[model samples]
Target: MNKQLIFFFLFVLFIIYSFSVYFSGTTYDKGISHFTTEAKLGKKLFQEKNCISCHQIYGLGGYMGPELTNIISYRDNDESIARAFLKGGTAKMPNFQLNDEEIDALISYLKYIDKAGNYPPKAYEITPYGTVNEIVTDEK
Candidate 1:
C-alpha cells in the first residue's frame, strides 16, 4: 500500500512539472514573437534617425561606435543601455538626445540588428526587460 501511495505521489509531481515546463515554453515563444515585432520597428527607426550613418549592423552602415548586432550580450542590464544611449560616449560619439520613446524604439532596432548576427559571435544574452540577453550557443 505504501508503495502505491509513493508511486501515485511521484506521478502527480511529474504531471505538474511537465505542465509547468510546457506552459513556460509556450509563454516564451509568444514573448519572442511579440518582441520580434518591436525589433522590426526598431530597425526602421535605426535607419530613419541616421544611426546607420555612424554605426553599422551586419556588415552595413558607417563605422562609429562598435557594431550593435550583439549588444544584448555585452551589457549586464538595461540601465547600462539607457545610460549609454542618453549620455552617449567620449568625444567621438555624441549623444543624440533621444527621448524615452525614441530610445525604446532604437533599442528595438538594435534588437533587429542583433538578430541579424552583426556583433561578435555569442554576444547577446536574454535580460528581464521584455527578453534580452538570450544567447543561442547552438545557433550554428
Candidate 2:
C-alpha cells in the first residue's frame, strides 16, 4: 500500500509538470508578433548582408563595429542619419549600395530590434563562479 501511494503521487506530479510545461506560453510571441512587414524584409536583408560580421545585435557579433541593439533610441530616433550612413559608407565601413527602399526597410528592422529589448542589460549580478547573470525587472 505504501509503495502504491508513492507511485500514484509521482504519476500525478509528472502529469501536472507536463501540463504546465506545455501550456505556459513563451514571452517572445508578443515581441515577434510586433514585427512589421518592412521589418521582416529588413531582417532578411540583414541576414543576406551578413552584417553580423561587423555589427552586433545584443553583443553577440564581432567587435569591429558597435553594438546596435538600441541604436534607433540612442540616436534619438534619427532616421536621417542612419539613412545617410547607409547611402554612403564611412572610411572604415563599406557601402552596400542599398537603395532608398532597402534603407527604409533596414531602418524599420532596426526600430523593431530597438523596441525588443536592451543590450548590456540595465542590471546584472556576477556569480561566484565569475559568470554574469542578467537581472530582469518589471518595466511595464
Candidate 3:
C-alpha cells in the first residue's frame, strides 16, 4: 500500500511539472516574432561566426564575453556596435571582419533582441522553493 501511494504521488508531481513547462511563456516578444529579412540574415551571421562561443544572449551562452541582451540600449547605439565589429575586439574577442551589410544585419538582429525584453531581469522576487518571479513593471 505504501509503495502504491509513493508511486501515485510521484505521478501527480510529474503531471504538475509537465503542465508548468507547457504553460510557461517564452522569452521572445513580438519583435522576434516579426523578424525582418535583415534580422534573419543577422541571426544566420551570428551563428555562422560562432558568436555564441563567447558572447551570450539572454544569459544562455558562454561567459567569455559579456551578455548582449540589452547591449544596444546601454552601449551607445547601432553605429557604435557596428564600429566594434569593424575595429575588432579586445584581447578576449576576435574580430570577424564582417562587411558593412553583415554588420548592418547584425545590428538589426540586435535591435530586435533589445526590443524583446530584459533578460536576467534587473529585479525579481525569489521564493523559498527557489522559483524566481519576475517583477514586471511599466517602463518609464
Candidate 4:
C-alpha cells in the first residue's frame, strides 16, 4: 500500500474518532428535565437559520435530509452535525458557522421534541427458544 493512502486513511480515522467523542458527550436522557428556555431560543435559531429549509421533523420543512425530530438517536452528537454543517460536504451542501452553545441549544430543543412525542414503553423478559418455552405462563 502507498504511504499517501495510509496517511489519508489514518487522518480519516482520527476525524471519525474525534466526532464520535464530541457527539456522545452531548447525549443524555436528562429525564423530565425542561429545556424550555433553551428550546425557545433554539426554535428561533432553527427558523431564522432556515434549518427546516432542508430538514424536516414530524412532517414539516424541506425534503433533503432525514427528519430531525429524533435526530439525537441518529447522529452521535451535535458536534458531528455541526462539523458537517461548518466543514461542508458535497457540492450542493453549504457550511454554517455556529458556536458550541448554539449547537447545544439546538440539540436540547430536538431532545425536548423527541421526549414530548413519546416512544413505546420498554419491556424486558428472559427467553430461551421460539419452539419451546423456558417457562410456561402461570394458569389459575
Best by lDDT: 2
lDDT tens digits by residue: candidate 4, 22-95 = 99978854443645888777777888888888887666778886577656544543447644653454565555
Candidate 2 residue-wise lDDT, 78-97, digit = tens:
87877887899898778999
lDDT string for model 1 (1-140, tens) is: 59999999999999999999999977653224435666667667666777778876666778776676566644542446644764565587777766776677667655544444535644576576767674656331
Q: How accurate locally, in lDDT, is each candidate?
A: 0.63, 0.82, 0.76, 0.64
What's each prediction's TM-score?
0.52, 0.65, 0.61, 0.50
- Candidate 2 structure lDDT: 0.82
Candidate 3 lDDT over 37-71, as tens digits, reads 99899889989988888888988898888888777
Over 4 Å off in model 2, which ranges?
A: 1-30, 123-140
How big is the positional error of residue 115 in model 1, measured in Å on the Cα after superposition? 3.0
Backbone clashes for every candidate come to 12, 0, 0, 1
RMSD of 3: 8.3
Reference-based TM-score, model 2? 0.65
Clashes of 2: 0
Evaluate residue 18 in candidate 3 and report its C-alpha lDDT on the 0 to 100 scale.
Answer: 88
Collision count of model 1? 12
